[model samples]
Target: MSTDVEINLLDNRWDASVASGMSESELLLYRSNVLGSDKRVTNYGGGNTSAKVLEIDPLTGEATEVLWVKGSGGDIGSIKMDGFATLYMDKLQALKSLYRGVEFEDEMVGYLPHCTFKLNPRAASIDTPLHAYVPRKHVDHVHADAIIAIAASKNSKDLTQEIFGDKIGWLPWKKPGYELGLWLDKFCRENPDADGVVLESHGLFTWADDAKACYDMTINVINQATEWLAQKSEGVAVFGGAKHESLDVDARRAVAASLMPAIRGFVGGNQHMVGHFNDSDAVLEFVNSQNMEPLAALGTSCPDHFLRTKIRPLVVDFDPAKGNLDEVMEGLPAQIATYRDDYAAYYERCKHDNSPALRDPNAVVYLVPGVGMITFAKDKATARIGGEFYVNAINVMRGASAVSEYVGLPEQEAFDIEYWLLEEAKLQRMPKPKSLAGRVALVTGGAGGIGTATAIKYLSEGACVMLVDINADGLATTVEALAAQFGGDVVRSVEMNVTDEGAVAAAMAETSVEFGGLDILVSNAGIASSAPVEETSLALWSKNLDILSTGYFLVSREAFKLMRVQDMGGAIVFVASKNGLAASPNASAYCTAKASEIHLARCLALEGAEGGIRVNVVNPDAVLRGSKIWEGEWLDQRAGTYGTDKEGLEEMYRQRSMLKRSVLPEDIAEAAFFLASDLSAKSTGNIINVDAGNKEAFTR
Candidate 1:
């Protein structure tokens, strides 16, 4: 272990000038944000920070000691002043008299609201007492990876002594509750000289009478552990050396694309689960390692890590060296079934009389032998976050197993935490999922007005959307706008031409890898050409057909491949035009292509019925506003064919309509949404005209 090791120490971000005029509570908020900004300091929404400050009581009209700590379910990295739960110190201290020992410590949670100061709505976290009883003005509890590595080590206590000597004390495993709070208080009192204590199998807690000192100590302590680990673990084989070499980047993604849809099919039986893929260096190192299976089986030690990542990861039976992805795909069903059975067995062995019933037996984290890691959850964000937690677990294993033996929380302990009633209550409080929750959709021509509108509609209802378009610039803008509104995890864009056979197939694979599998396909990619039969060039006819008829067929063929792979019923909604049914004087090519689109839908619906893949069409008429097809020559040509100017064409169509109304892209989007959603589950091979009222285009 004499190799040169470089350590990137956590920066002490606190500035004297920045801290000069802030109130004590403000300083705590500042410290929490800075600490949480680094994942090495703490995982997202993990850990707690607090400061006991004197505030004037609104009710009592007296300066009173109030405990302000990070609220439940809030991330400190982005917490605001209002994110802290404020409780009266005297009321919190009084709860000790109400405590009925460790067995009944959970009941103490019921009394927390009674201690609320000024009727603050933000609920205090379970770790409230851990900070409240610390007897310090400021306290921070963080799940810094370096510290947790030491805490999760088999010789955690000895390692703590070796690293920091008596400056930091050690506490054996105790699930956070009223009792652990008391244990923390007693330890601080007994060891007055200690700056912090490392909670075994959990995290680190550091406190000081001043906010800056507390923040400094937390960073300093973690940095010390990091430096020490780098020194001790240098030149040591990481994760028992890589058992398999990582596949090339393209090959890794190809494996993921092949596997994700299949895995998603099995796991999404309970509910549709979106997927996330991680091929980061850290993930690749662990997944390719000899110790990956053993370490993963031991599960994650930290509560936050396990809470999101589950008790353990499912190890995919893939051999990267042989590149036996086909064999692995064949074995996935049994592998998944085994994981579910194992999870059920774990539940049966560990359940208490009042334990919450077994949760989704599906694995959250999937470790491939060399490709990388895959995670599936009810949504993209959760799936992505789950992968992040597993990465943290990998980091912990790298350090702990290198120094000593890495130990996960005991099975019984992990089960208790997993099935904790408090955690169950929190889950029950979550809002009901939206209409399209957990479903993934791909919109062709997605950068266009109709495509963008449909995407927004689906996203508003909780669907993850993959926007596909030939327009790279438009796709990027649309992706950015949608990501800002719905979050980056749920929105993705692919620059693809629907008529290109290879591009279409690649886009389908990309969709599967991006969001598990496709549940909905909005075939809106099209072109319009207005010309009399004699004047219409063969090139124009072919161009219209290639983009409209041939493009839809290409996209649908790929969609069917993925849908069939998933074996999950899917919806394909074709955004054809009203001209499909109604013949105009000069727009033969445009009308014929649209008519072909409708016919194709009818054909697909017949073919897909047995497989539960519903195909439908939405025919929009005179949708001049925000319609990309009407932007250039088509608009002028349509206006000339209708004996009107460009601006007058919409009015003519509106006046001619039975209901006399203009059509817009959003109107088409609404019709498209209905056909794609479960709302139209029983209806297929159907056409909905979003033309205000076009009797000629009406379905018979």
Candidate 2:
């Protein structure tokens, strides 16, 4: 409830630097980072900042006032000097005269670019004009959660007035453009005493002659709102305990497993999709609250959120203990159809002549009682961002509900901003996303050399991967390394025996829940057993078949079932060995088991081809550098057979190949990637040899 700003941290970092020397632009960049680093002030790329500074015009070599504002697609948290787009202040100010009823989408957007100081200044932020119009050297804007909670309430104007007195002006939600900028300029001119402006249901804006003052003002205003809300809800508990208690963990997992595939299929469309279940304490509390339905349907907390979360979430009815998934499945299609129909109607009701084409009408967030929330998107990043936004939204709504009824922007108003060309153009300006951007992949024996390499390859191509292995220690180490490289959300680990049917099924279910659906399965789990047929024990032969052959079958069968449910074609790659095609002495058991794995892939290819599911195999040989299989007795045995030390054995195997090259795990990984990707769209039931030049193992 304290309305104090944390100015000490800034003082510590800036006091000495300020005394020495700091340019206006550098100070602005430093302040922008400070503001953006706080999630309470800005979430992701949701805010903009600027500083008006004197700069020498390149052509004239004379000092001129310029407005440097955060550029489009630039994250304030990590922005640099180049991150701000520079525009001539006089030229931008002169644009006010031309805004005589000129619509933002029509002539104003086209004119703003002409006022830039440079030929092609970094695409100026959509709110560039708002900053230019604010009569201050430094300006900071943020979608502060505390301010949002108050600004989005039913009586926001009164609440804002009560908290900030007449020192703050209130502007009704207006799509950011020329008109909005002009209106703000006129308002400030009239109400010179106001320190800032609150855009109803949008965000807050504060400005001052100094960067520190502007940042301090932002924190102070947000703190005031937070304290007011805290005082109002001191003793009142708005969200009562759940009327329907949460189901046990086991039952919840079962419910998620049963319901996720159908939901994934219904919303997948043609693009590969993934789902993430967020069961954090906040999410669970929100889902289980007595007023969950009404508060959730109220609408998104802000207009920008619409682009990511849609207008409202889809709320499904479920009694965790008594609900029948079959019944839920039977009604799901109709529910989705209705959701789409309603969205289409909303578009029809709000569409303007210049509005962009309607986007697909699918709910990005799903609220299920006793199971928490499920956020869906084409890729993991978007889904995770959407999930985080919703969690913030829930908190805002909860706080606002305790003070006053939560109110979002009007539907027509939201539509205007959602389809605004100025906003839509930002998305178009982005580079094309990766091919496997939103797909989920599962790899068995993911701690091993070939499996680890293949997982990294999939991650590099933008797929979220789940690494399954029975080696708990190795799995933990591998997952930690990969997560550090590709972000923790993009990589996950599951320890389970692929040969265990129950465990494999559970793992597949976990994958589906963690990431919406499985699109790629790499059956790379195997054990190397070298023994002559006569010397091989019944246990040794059965063990090889169970892991190398049967394990592949179990994992593939589970993946195929999920892919079939998703109805989206998937890819499966089996890491077999060159010995499968050409038998090796003292490796009878290993050869037979690998051969069984190859045939299993072929049979799967036939059955899966009709469903657009591709099944392929990669045959690799002597990948000893990183191979865990080459450790201990296996290393000594191979070296002895080659009549030299382990080091010499690697060279001996390399020279045996026609190419005289060492077969590395990365080499096999490359082939697996091609088969997993669309590069092999027309290919299935094929064996790609990763061996350098094994003529005997070549698939002819």
Best by lDDT: 1
List model 2 lDDT by residue over 115-189, tens digit each: 787665687876888899988899888887778888788888988898899888898877777777877889889
Tens-place lDDT per residue, model 1, 489-530, is 889989999889999989988988889899999999877888
Task: Report every candidate's CA lDDT.
Answer: 0.92, 0.84
**Which numbered prediction scores highest in TM-score against the true structure?**
1
Worst 10 residues of 2 by lDDT: 1-10
Give candidate 2's TM-score.
Answer: 0.93
TM-score of each: 0.99, 0.93
Off by over 4 Å in 1: 1-5
For candidate 2, give the lDDT of residue 438.
80
